[model samples]
Target: ASAFYPAALGQTTLEQWHDLFASNAQAPFFLSQHLAPLLKANQGCIINIIDALAEQANPDFIPYSMAKTALRTLTTALAKALAPEVRVNGISPGAMLWPDGEHQLTEQQKQKILQQIPLQRVGTEWDIARTLYFLVEEAPYITGQDIAVDGGRSLNSVQLHAP
Candidate 1:
């Protein structure tokens, strides 16, 4: 499933927020639940593509953050609910794709974001894909985990007060 949804507060209505949550979070949970039998029989895995904002608050994108956080919670819940039959995990991506058109970032904004990432770069889609492959094919003993494929962006630390 894709994590495409509308963001922005105030401009986004309550109904829009609900729709975003339903599509981003609820759909995955229900789909997984509906496919539980098939997954259990085949020992399958569910990998959710959440957002890095799920782990942190983004004042500018409250709805999107909430939806992703819900998905993250659902991933852990399903992992336990599905148990040994099916593995459930999540990948939270950070700055993998540039926003198009009006949402595009300025060079300064882009540099600021990159500087926050310890790796000083954005991740590739392939990074997330490889992690998914590992969770499914190699991580037999692993479940109920959310891997951050974020090029260390999530580890960026803020100094509330400078040293």
Candidate 2:
């Protein structure tokens, strides 16, 4: 389960941090651990859906960002640990969908984000799906890598900091 709790560092509580980690990082870790034997037996793969901002410092969404970054690290570790049997990789998607509820954006904010993407548009779910298909079915030798299906949004650092 991916979490997107947004809060500043000073405003975030320890419980929120733990909850974010539990949802974003810990759950995947333990699930993979429990499924490792089966995965190895069947030669299955693990593809983690991560955020494109996982490597960046998101001050407004501190705990969520930290948790995702931890998941990114976990992806690498799992890839190494599960190698030669099961492949593990991550997909870091950017601006694929609009944030709902309290995190919803205005039209201007949305436009600003679109401008940052080299494709000048948001990504579709199919974008991620095709990438996943490629990784699982075609990319046999690829592992421990993160593919950014962000329409080149990850190529620019200014998108996440839109005002």
Candidate 3:
């Protein structure tokens, strides 16, 4: 349930990400430090919320895609090793929640997002929630998989922006 900064490589991205690269990609290591504690508590499941960019690189987001792709890899690797004691998986949500008051969302912007989705509509948070619910409640046998809650958006290349 976290959001990243402007991924709109819409020309303003470089200015936004200059410092991130120079910054040591530090969070994963810190999180890695906590894995043992979570396992000990028997809360051995990790649900990674990856981004839309994990599957498709939008014209507006190259770095974001790169980062999320790395995260997707982690999701798989961790799941394999943590089996029996822990489960690690991911869910990639697309257009589930509008940025709302944090970001100025206009009808045109909403339309632009939908234009890139085959469903011709954005997803509601409930869509993502239900998908996660299945991964958690219904699928104990299903581990190490990533469920994409994108309203089938990732399937259509033309429906996504390419950089």
Candidate 4:
């Protein structure tokens, strides 16, 4: 894709990873490769959970971010292309969970994040699941957009410190 977000992907060359992520010319792309059939059958919607860090800021996971951003864009494009039949949308989650195989988090680190959230707490998996359920089963008219479940982290600017 571009330069600034250059990061080593596992063990593969950065260029190779970039090609795999940003500009794959293969058929079905990704979700369509598998879900095209299922979605058509069930007339279901696509809820792609694009990470908040995707197009945001991060020193680590830069390559992953680039890939997710492409996925997010695809969600919008797919929604429009499949409109009046299939629905597609994205959810951008911010600081939802620590990465797997977690190490201990410092109290300061935890407080720093909590303060940024207007809700003043971290999000849980249930929060996401319920939201999806609503947009899918409840909101029949919704599509082609993202509902940010960030607890207002995107608006954060003021510094927070643990007492």
Residue pairs with clashing backbones, model 1: none
**Candidate achieving higher TM-score, 1 or 3:** 1
Per-residue lDDT for 109 in model 2?
99
Runs in model 1 lying further than 4 Å from the true structure = 1-6, 157-163
Rank by lDDT, highest first: 2, 1, 4, 3
Q: lDDT for model 1, on a 0 to 1 scale?
A: 0.85
Candidate 1 matches the true fold with a TM-score of 0.90
Candidate 2 lDDT over 104-126, as tens digits, reads: 89999999999899998898889
Candidate 3 Cα lDDT to native = 0.69
Tens-place lDDT per residue, model 3, 1-163, is 2336545655655644543322212354247447747773675566777777678757666666666777778778877766777777788887776776768699899898888787887788788788788887777777778887888787765466679
Worst 10 residues of 4 by lDDT: 20-29
Worst 10 residues of 2 by lDDT: 153-162
**lDDT, candidate 4, residue 6?**
38
- Angstrom error of the Cα, residue 107, model 3: value is 2.7
Q: What is the lDDT of residue 14 in candidate 3?
A: 62
RMSD over all Cα atoms, model 4: 6.9
The candidate scoring highest on lDDT is 2
How many residue-pair clashes does candidate 4 contain?
0
Which residue pairs show collisions in model 3? Answer: 9-60
